[model samples]
Target: MADVEYEPGSEAASNILKDLQEKLQTDTELQERAQELILNIQDIRASVNAAKAGAGTHRRGGDEVQLIAVSKLKPASDILALHAAADGGQVHFGENYIQELWKKHAILPTTISWHFIGGLQTSSISKLARIRNLYAVHSIDSAKKAVTLNRLRPDGFPVVNVFVQVNTSGEDSKSGVEPEVDGGELWDVISTIRKECPKLNLVGLMTIGAIARSQAAKEGEENEDFVALVKVAEGLEGRIEREEGVKVELKLSMGMSDDFESAIGIGAGFVRVGSSIFGARPKKADASIL
Candidate 1:
């Protein structure tokens, strides 16, 4: 093909138009992705609404579901877009690894609140405590972890919000306090933290429901877990409130990308969503990435 020469102004205009077209296409794709997210969010919201309506029939407080988008393993760009869409609403973002979270927080604005959603080792507690906007630590299942967090909390912060993770399914490999109706040893641990660890606030309870093959199966199973967590929270609420002298709010941090709706229906104040919000994550090379 012969090279066709054009006037300088004409060539500039043509290049500008091509750039604009590409930008428009990129915007369209982004909008489409955002719309899909909004639909999924609406479905979750609807489930919470139905649960709230049903709660009125009973004498309990209506379901007040708080969606905590699990942003672990996703790119910072994706988190920024999701937060922009949220429009300043207080949305909780959950992270698994301390290093990954530190990187994300460094890049992301401090206004976005975060929850540490993974297992906490004694060593990492000091670093986790330093993050100013860390709203809650969801996997504080044992006294050891609680003590570590209490010791590491920065000065001037009244208390670090935390949840006692209860393993309702009794799986040995699961990461939570084994559910005890009497609150058993865990109760004593909570009391110790309350009394000794002046900087830590035992806010509520959390758990990971038994995994199921499909979304429907997951939802059915998680609903029971969610309800059980609520009962546990209600049971502990009286004692914790009386002792702490602060209204101990029961926050249920359950649900993944799969069964969030059911979790909300049973009153999950915070649902941790991962893949559904950020899309499938890239595979990690090793355990270090986690």
Candidate 2:
């Protein structure tokens, strides 16, 4: 050790040097991670813009296309980050699982509206009905489900907005009503709700886009499917309006990360997005993640 006289500022200089060393170590990785997140955000914005542009010249009514960010199985932090970036309180989020949705709702601000985007069982009706800011329910495909929801809805709230899900592709495993069903049966179910269900408001119809492997194939196929669903909705719109004694504003809740542009172009008022905004989901331990 040099036992010579040390300079007066040596201790102060050493302390500053130590602080800088620690800060450099801590901030470099943090800055890199932040930069990566920014780049990802840019990519998401580009995709969204492309979708909006591809949607093309559809006369936007007073209502714009509402983007419901599907946050199923995603961490709450990711949702927070998205909310921070959004403007005009425009972000509406959707969740598939009841428990996860509840958890996220607990952590997220009340200002953000939540949509139940999954097939809701009767047992979960009470929990869903109690959520004060639930913007809409997108999977009310059956009269029974509608009845259950009507029964459980809390007093003093406006009727919960609901979309009748139609299975346009006629897939056996899918969870929506077939759009090409008997007219009597369809009208019976829909009319029953209009007459009887006081707490549920029939706002629109939702259908899944035809799932295809390639982007071009998916777009072409889904455009056909979307056009079909739109025709079905258009066919029923006047009927529902006549029965309800008011012009029913019908929303077509179709499209996802892949085919939303086509859906939008064909008049999708609501588009559900998940992986496109949150990035690729982490693979499940046993199941393949989509």
Candidate 3:
């Protein structure tokens, strides 16, 4: 794929984003991303939708899998192009950094649901809680962070949906709860969030499988961590019901650009995909928290 030049600060790009943001309510802003990238996104979406349709297990409903465009590091113009894609493109986008996420969110229309898919710093929580259209946070690894988010959530704001990020791979370098038979510390963190944080809606679990585990898995077999996340979700179900007295819908958020298809096959309700759609990112400082 050839690189498409998109100057985010250029007047043309500014006009483009502004025009799209203004026309969001009307149906006039249906222009797709740049041809090559648009086609790429379309192709990826078709493949994912097919996998969702053919899923033999974990079939929940018509709305089974959500394809979250991991828009971090990509230019705003690139994001706008993909958002203008024909098939519900302006829905979900995931960002990894606090500063970058807020910058994009401010420019994009509220119709675009933003997912904070990175580590949440203690200081950043208050600011994030104030964003009116933040749809979900895919990496809540600590009970204290959950509590802070809950308390700082803007008054009258809807409950912010969150997922307990479990370190299913047991990698010391990762920033998530260690996965175990009963979720180990994962259970305690989520349970505390559920009981104490009324402003937060504990929705599901998320995990970034270890690279080695992904490579070691055979073609027919799912990654060990991916399979473990499913079991951890299952184990937490009964306990969640017993403790909360409410049947919460728990979804699994796993997989990335490399293993989303396999993750979807197993039962990933949400997949954070990037390069396959937008092309590779330039090497830069890591944006992920912790």
The most accurate candidate by TM-score is 3
- Tens digit per residue, CA lDDT, model 3, 55-165: 765563235888898888876666766676666565788988877776676555567888999987999987788777899999999898998999999889778889999
Number of clashing residue pairs, candidate 3: 0
* Candidate 1 residue-wise lDDT, 1-290, digit = tens: 01122222245434543443344347876567666665655565566567566545442334466677777776654555566565443357889888777656554556778889898888888878877778889888778888888887888864678888888767787788767746576686667767787787766778888655224454235456766778888877777677667776566777776766566656667778777666777765422211
What C-alpha lDDT values do all the predictions have? 0.68, 0.68, 0.77
Error of 3 at 235 (Å): 0.6
Local lDDT at 28 for model 3: 36
Q: Write the per-residue lDDT of candidate 2 for residues 9-101, one digit (tens) a residue.
A: 345434433453344346776345434444554565566567667656663323367778887876554555455443433368898876666
Kindly indicate the candidate among 2 and 3 with the higher lDDT. Answer: 3
Q: Rank the candidates by TM-score, best first.
A: 3, 2, 1
The candidate 1 region of ten consecutive residues with least summed lDDT is 1-10
Estimate candidate 2's RMSD in Å: 12.5
TM-score of candidate 3 versus the correct structure, residues matched by position? 0.84
Pairs in steric clash, model 2: none
- Shift in Å, residue 237, candidate 1: 2.9
Residue-level error in angstroms, candidate 3, position 54: 3.4
